[model samples]
Target: MRGGNTNGPDGNLRKDVETALLRPNLTPWQRTFLTDIHARLERSGGQARLSDKQWRKIFEILGRPNNVIALPPRTVTAYPPRRQPSKLFRPRFGWVGRRLRWRLRNLAIGFLIVAAVALGQQVFNLGRGQFQSTPTSTRALQTQEFSVTDGDTVHVVGEATGTRLVGFNTPEKFSPQCEYERQLGERASSRLRELVAHGSIQLTKVACACAPNTEGTSECNFGRSCGVLQVDGKDVGSILISEGLAVSFVCGRTSCPPAPRPWCKG
Candidate 1:
């Protein structure tokens, strides 16, 4: 035989085994199995000596032959003899533990992939104008304007707006995708600043989205609104998009900005 039942780590199984063997009602086979198990446990320090199969032999020996559970023969090793990796194949708690860990690892990987797909789908729907709950419109709002933070982002002097120019998005100054993205972002910011610097810039809130600024650590509007920036009655978005400095987009209604993306890449 490749191996017999290993001794139990705990001494309890052997105690039960010893008590059963001493019973006067035991059949000859039962007495014999118990005696052998007791002896092996003693030799091994404190545990049952029977291999899992040998331990199971007690069930058959004690049970009426006809009433015995239909378990595999105890004579067979948990792992068949002569197999190359008989050790891992053994039906022991150790092997079961390893199998469980492997299963959990695969399950975690599956969850990550599922989450990624779901996030991607949401972005796709946003770009396709599927958000119906929030409506978009373009209206020239006359308000006290403060400064142009970037090409598309603007901040009102006294917290009056969370507005960004609709219809188009510029490269991100905070988080750029690549060198090209960074360069484009700087150029866009400069252009918008120049446009506002000269005379006056008015926002035509057209096709606006209710996108929240998520970058606020506590209380700050870091996000921009989607709208047409009206300069002398001309659309700033149209000009920038035409010049390739910005891209045509609807903030929450259309697609999100793309390029060197990690947060936006979803």
Candidate 2:
């Protein structure tokens, strides 16, 4: 009788109904009480199901208040544990060290090669008599035409050629009064012609002071032999000197005379 309502819609009338059953205005405490009751009923296998929106509202109510609990201090932990003193300071022999050593070796080799080449050049120049200083003038002979007069003397076409020949005195051409001298001269001349006839000869011009003869022929005061005359890398003067056909007559300020031998005197 306490639970029945006589005016319930579509129901047969019950004799007893409470006035509190029709009340709609519940207080906050009463609402809380009803919520707890409803939750208990749901746990006891009631027909009510919590949708997504209702669950979110319930979660928000249970979460911590904004100013109540402070978050733990944030910490940055490094990955891959840091090296200790011994490990951190250990020496590493890497490719960089090897590369530096190799570079140094190459530099030393390059320096050695340069030094060797320089030394070789010095030795070569010394051996070839290039270090010997001879005073040679740049004056051209007035006469360009010259003929093989004897072994050493060359006849010129004009007075200028004879003047130019003053510094280089050769043997007389076919002299009867000095027949022995003439024969020696002819022999020397023939030998020279044979040696350089078809070969290229480089004439080096020189200047000197020597009196010309009445026939306008000049003689070499420094003697006619010495110095270098190269042919295919062979020293012509040295060859003749070695053969005793010519003497090593140092010319210019250096006063070395020709050897007083029979072959060289003529």
Candidate 3:
């Protein structure tokens, strides 16, 4: 009834639709409503043709269905975080190399400290005249074997060794500090020569107090040997000290005090 126009007296169109609905290919709705629609058309004497709404429904049923493909929803998988490398996987010698370098550096520093101590000890021993060894055997000497150098020093005739008396020191004759000292030194030297010339001279060699590795060097009393001089079992040093010619010159293990010179005193 709501269509734009009504059909005319077209009995042929109604007969044609009836003929199509009777066919075997017709839908269930088309077949069931076919008799109803024909009876109505007969009642109206085919004055009303099929409406546009009924025709549109029949055409829609005859068309193809939608072609939508149904797929499952997208899935997202979660994985664990990336693992970091362990110490085992690192370079094998990296720690070893660092430790070895540290040890070597320490060893080098230790060596330098040891060397510095040794050098300092050597420097401290200088001019100290440290006592080394004492000889117990007495050596008897003839007049030709040695010659008196001064009041307390003697030179071996053929040997290059020089001897310094251990117990006493006289004023310097070769390098005197004053004229009176020179005169006293000459008298002391004359007295020593007279004592050694007449009596049985006994010389006992003693190791000079010197620094390590400096026994032959100039630091060791110019390479002079130390000795105790005795004539006829009497110590020459005692006789000289008692006669007011030389001063008592005692030495400790490492050093000796400057000899007290009476001749040079004002």
Q: Least accurate stretch of 10 residues (summed lDDT) in model 2?
A: 12-21
Whole-model lDDT, candidate 2?
A: 0.40
Candidate 3's C-alpha runs over 4 A off are 1-138
lDDT of 1 at 154: 67
Per-residue lDDT of 59-110 in model 1, one digit per residue for the tens? Answer: 4444423121222235654865664666766666587889998999999999
**How would the candidate models be sorted by lDDT, starting from the highest?**
3, 1, 2
Error of 3 at 191 (Å): 0.6
| Candidate 3 lDDT, 52-89, residue by residue in tens | 22333333333423222123244788998999899787
Query: Candidate 3: what lDDT?
Result: 0.67
**Model 2: pairs clashing at backbone N, Cα or C within 3 Å:** 143-161, 151-189, 166-219, 167-220, 169-220
Q: Report the lDDT tens digits of candidate 2 across residue range 91-135.
A: 776999789889999999999999999999999887566435433
Error of 2 at 127 (Å): 33
TM-score of each: 0.36, 0.30, 0.47
Q: Candidate 2, which segments miss by more than 4 Å at Cα?
A: 1-145, 155-159, 163-180, 209-230, 233-235, 254-266
